[model samples]
Target chain A: MSAFYSVLKRELRSYFASPLAYIILVVFQVISARFFFLYLQGFLQFQLDPSYQLQTGDLNLNNLVILPYFGTISIVLLLIVPLITMRLIADEKKNYTAELLFTSPIHIRTIVLGKFAAALILLIMMLLLSSVNVFVLMVHGNPDLGAVLSGYTGLFLLGASFLSIGIFASSLTDNQLIAAVISFGVLLVLWLVGALSDAESSILGYLSVINHYEDFGKGIVDLKDVVYYVSLIFLGLFLTYSALESERWR
Target chain B: MVYVHNLTKRYGNLTAVENLSFQLERGDVLGFLGPNGAGKTTTMRIITGYMPPTKGTVHIEGVDIFDEPLQAKRVIGYLPENPPLYNDMTVMEYLSFVADIKKVGRKEKKSRIFYVMERCGIAEVRRRIIGHLSKGYRQRVGIAQALVNNPSVLILDEPTIGLDPRQIIEIRELIKSLSGDRTVILSTHILPEVTMICSKVIIINHGKIVLEESLQKLSEDMRSAESILLRTRQNGEGVVEKIHALGNVSSVKPGAAGEYIIVPRKGAEVREELSRLAVENDWGLLELRPVTNTLEEVFLKVISSEGN
Candidate 1:
C-alpha cells in the first residue's frame, strides 16, 4: 500500500510539474463551457416556442441542457483522457525509470493502480471545474440536483474507463505518441460500436462503452452499468500487469 | 550474502548469460570485468531481481529470487549501465520515492535519505532538478538513490563509464567508503578499476567466466610468469639460436627494435648468464630489464587464450 502511494504521489507530481496538466484543464474547461452555453440557448428557445409546448414533457431542462452537455463532455473526454494517461507508464519506460520500479520491492499491480488513480484524480478535477455550468443552473434556476449528480457520476465512469484502457496502451510501448494513438484508436472503435449495432440488447451494443453511459446521463445509475465499467477497469489493469510481466522475460 | 548458480538467460536463439555461477560473502567487492555485450549487465540485472533467468536460481540471503522476488529485492540496490532516473524530479524527491519503495521505515526515512545524499556528495544539490544537473551530479543522484535503503548487496554496472577523471576518482572514493560491511559487485571492462576497488575479480568473455580469482592471487600469478627484455644496440645474428641453446632459457622471441624477449625456465636465474653471453657475442646490450605484466596483458592473455 505504501508503494502504491509513493508511485501515485510521484505520478501526480510529475503531471503538475509540466505545463501539460494546466493546459489540459484549461482546454477542457473552455470546450465544456462552450457546449453548455450552446445547449442553454437552444433550451431557452424551445421553451419560448409555441410549437414546442406540445412536447413540453420531453423538453425539460435535463433533456434540453444537462443531458446534452454531459454527452458532449463524454466525447471530449475520449480525446483528453488519453493525453492524461499516455505518459503514465510510457514515460517511465522511455526514461528507463521503469528499471528502478521493477527492481524495487513492489508488486506490478501497485504500480498500475497508482498510475490509474492519479489519472482518475485529475479527471475528477476536470469534472469539478466544468460543473460550474451546472452550479450556475442551481443558483439562478431550478435544476434537478439528483439528475445533475448522476450525470457527473456517468461522466466519471466514462472517463475512468478511458483512463484504464489508456494505461493499458501506455504499457504496450515506450513512445508516448504511439501510446496516445493506440488508446484513441481503441476508444474510437468502442464509441462507434454503439451506433454500429441496431439493437440495444445485441452483444456489440451492450459491449459499447458509451451505450452503458446513456442510462447515467438520464439520471439513472443502474447496477448493470456500474458492473460493466468496473469489469472494464479490471480487465484493463489485468492486461497491463500481464504486459509488464512479459517484458521482464524479454 | 549472494549466491548465483547455473544462471542462463536465452532470448530465443541468442544466449546472453550461459551456465554462470558465482557467490559472494559479506563485505566482498567482486569486480565483474567484460568487454561490451559480454553479458555483464545481463547478469547484474538477473541478480537484482529485475529479470528472471531461463535456467537456474539466485539466492539472496537464503531467499530464492524467483520464488520470493520482493524479499530478494529488498536487500539489493542496483545501478544499471544507464542510471534510471526521473529527469523532472528533484534529487530529494527521487531519493524519497526510492526510499519509500524500498520499504525504509518511516522513522529512518528522513535520516537515510540525508545520509545517502551526503554520502554520495549530492547534498548540495538535493533540491535541484535532476534534468538540469550535469552528468556527474546525475550519476551521483543515481548512486544516492541506490543507497537510500542501505541495501546489503549493491550492484553497480559501469558506474564511472562516462565521468571525467576527477569525477571518476570522486565516485571511486565514494564507492570505496561505502564498502564497509556491505557486499558490492562493481562491473566494468576497465582493468585498473578492478585493481583499485575490488578484492576479488571475475573476467567474463562470450557469456562465460574466463577467470575468477582473488586480487592477491591474480597479482601473484602475474608475477610468477617471469620474462626479461634484452635490447641491444648492435643487431647480432644467431642471437635467438644462442638464447634457445642456453639451458636456462625456455623460449626467445624477437621484440621491437631488435630487442629479444626471453622467458626463463622455472627456478632459473638467466639474467647473469644472458649478460655474459651478450659480452661474449659482442652485442652492445643497451637495456636489460624484467618485464612485469600489467592487468591488461593478463586480461588479454585470458581472453585470447580462451578463444583458442
Candidate 2:
C-alpha cells in the first residue's frame, strides 16, 4: 500500500510539474462550459413545455436545461480523460524510467494502480471544476440536486472507464501519440457499438459505453450499469498489469 | 557475497548470455570486461533481478534472485549504462523518489539521500533539474540512486563510459572508495579502469567467460613472459644478430631507427646477457627495458583467444 502511495504521489507530482494537468483542466472547462451555455441558449430559444419530459418525469424547466448540459459535459470529459492518461505508461517507457520502477521492490500492480489513481484524481479535479456549471444553474433557477449529483456520478464512472482504456493503450506502446490515438479509437468504438447494432442485440448494447451510461444519465442508479462500468475498469486494469509484466520478458 | 551458476539468457534464438558462471565475495571489486553486444548488460540485469534468466540461477547472499526477488534485490543496487532519470524532476526530488521505492525508512531517507549525494559529489547540484545538469552530474545522480539503499552489492554497467577525463578520475575514486564493504561488479571494456579499480576481472566474449582472474595475479603471470626493448647505436643487422645470439633470447626483431625488440624464452631474463653482448660488439646500449603488459594487452589477448 505504501508503495502504491509512493507511486501515486510521484505520478501526481509529475503531472503537475508539467503543462499536462493545466492543459487538461483548461480544455475540459472551456468545452464543458461552452456546451452548457449553448444548451441553456437552446432551452430559452425553444421555450419548450416545462412538464413534458421522459420516463422519470419530474419535469421542470431546470431538468430540461441541465440534462442536456450534463450530457455535453460527459462528451467533453470522454474526449479529455484519454489525453491525460495516454502518456502515463507510454512516456515512462519512452524515457526508460520504466526500468527503475520495474527493478524496484514494488509490485507491478502497485505501479499500475498508482498511475490509475493519479489519472482518476486529475479527472475528478476537472469534474469538480465543471460542477460550477451546476452551481450557476442553481443560482439562476431551481434545479434537482439529486439529478445533478447523478449526472456527476455518471461522469465520474465514464471518466474512470476512459482512463482505464487509456492506461491499457499506453502500455501497448512506447509512443504517447500512438497511445492517445489508439485509446481514443477504442473509446469511440465502444461508444458507437450500440449504433452499429440494434438494441435487440443484447451483447452489443452490453458492450456499448453509452448504453451503460444512459441509466446514470437519467438519474437512475441501476445496479447493472454500475457493475458494467466496474467490470470494464477492472478488465482494463488487468490488461495494463499484464502489459507491464510482459515488458520485463521483452 | 554473490554467486551466479550457469546463467543463460536467450531472446528468441539468439543467446545473450550462455553458461556464464562466477562468484563475488564480499569486498571484492569485480570488473566485467566485454566487447559491445557481449551480454555484459544482460548478465547484470539478470543478476539484479530486473530480468529472470532463461536458464540457471543467481544467488545473492544465498538467496536466489528469481525465487526471492525482493530479498535478493534488497541486497543489490544497479546502475544501468544509461542512468534512468526523470527529466522533469530535480536531483533531490529524483533521489527522494528512489528512496521511497527502495523502501528506505522515512526517518532515514533525508540523511541517506544527503550521504549519497555527498559521496557522489552531487550535493551542490541537488536542487538542479536532472535534465539541465551536465553528463557527469547526471552520472553521479545515477550512482547516488544506486547507492541510496546502502545495498551490500552494487552492479554498475560502464559507469564511466561518457565522462571527461577529470570526471572519469573522480568517478573511479568514488567507486574505489565504495569498495571494502560492498561487493561491486563494475562492467566496462575500458581496460585501464579495470586495472585501476578492480581487484578481480572477468573478461567475457561471444556470450561466455573467456578469462576470470585476479588483476594482480594475471599481470604477475604475464610479467614472467615479458619482452624487452633494446635500443642501440648499432645498425639493425648488428643489434638483431647480437641480441638473438644472447643466452635464453628466443627471437629479436629490428625496430624503428636501429632499435630492437627481443622476446626471451618463458621464465627467461636475457637483459644482462644482451647488455654484455652489446658491450662485446662495441654497440652502445641506448635503452634496455623489460616490457610489462598493460591491462590493454591482457584484454586484447583474452578477446583474441576467445575469437580463435
Which predicted model would earn the best lDDT? 1
Top DockQ: which candidate number?
A: 1
Model 2 C-alpha lDDT per residue in residues B1-308, reported as the tens digit of each score? 99999998999999999999999899999999889999999999998888888899899989998888877877678898889999989999999999988888888889999999999999999999899998888988999999999989999999997899998999999999999789999998688888899999898998999999998898888797688998887664556665666668788878776688888998887888888888787777799899888878878888998798
TM-score, B chain alone, candidates in order: 0.87, 0.93
**lDDT (10s digit) by residue, model 1, range B224-285:** 78699999985678999998888888889897776999999876889998998898888888
Q: Name the Cα RMSD for model 1.
A: 2.5
Candidate 2 residue runs with Cα over 4 Å from true position: A46-62, B236-248, B268-281
How big is the positional error of residue A124 in model 2, measured in Å on the Cα after superposition? Answer: 0.5
- Distance from true position, residue A180, model 2, in Å? 0.6
lDDT of each: 0.90, 0.86
DockQ of each: 0.74, 0.64
> Model 2, A42: alpha-carbon shift in Å?
2.5
Query: Model 2 — TM-score against the truth?
Result: 0.95
Question: What C-alpha lDDT does candidate 1 achieve relative to the native structure?
Answer: 0.90
